[model samples]
Target: MYYSRKRQPDDLPQEVTAIWSCTNEECNGWMRDNFAFSAQPRCVQCNSLMEKGERKLSILENTSPNHSKKK
Candidate 1:
């Protein structure tokens, strides 16, 4: 039996999403804005300040009851 591990294009739906990107050039850390716990989030990896940005990313919903979304 041959099994392919690769994901097909239709498997993931992408959208231009709001995100927080690390201000530090050395850090490649980023996260979806909707999932961020704060208005201004810090990089989880480097603890550096983050800036608002957008990227073409796979659509994912945050279903955790405790997770709040504040604009």
Candidate 2:
């Protein structure tokens, strides 16, 4: 008889925080979330392109390091 090991599911990456803002400067809307490694998110208020603002290195917290670096 041959024995085989079971395969386990891949672990999720560390929660990276980001702030998404609306492309329309007039709206100037924004939001924040613990973005997963495999998910695409958009602005909740204006439904505009969500740009990656900044990254948070702590748990249970949301920080925007590049709030002024919008593209």
Candidate 3:
């Protein structure tokens, strides 16, 4: 007999948007999504520290098999 393990899910993907903004309260500036995953992000308008915003799951598409038990 052989044994096997199931694979685990990976980290959730970051939010993808066409536009963004700086996180610095003092320097509220608008930014773009081109620099989302980069180590450093600066607000082009105010050159302030920027952080990715919370992800919003607007679209839902199930890729897993329907495993619901029949009644």
User: lDDT tens digits, residues 1-71, model 2?
Assistant: 99767543333344466656567776776555443222456566676666657554344442555333323
Give residue 61's error in model 1 in angstroms.
0.2
Q: Which predicted model would earn the best TM-score?
A: 1
Put down candidate 1 lDDT per residue, 1-71, tens digits, no spaces.
99999999788999999999999999999999999988889999999999999999999889989788665
Best by lDDT: 1
Residue 60 C-alpha lDDT in model 1: 87
Ranking of candidates on lDDT, top first:
1, 3, 2
TM-score quality measure for candidate 2: 0.38
TM-score of each: 0.83, 0.38, 0.34
Give me the overall lDDT of model 1.
0.93
lDDT of 3 by residue, 6-61 (tens): 53334344445444668778776764444344446677767787766544433333
Query: Higher-TM-score candidate among 2 and 3?
Result: 2
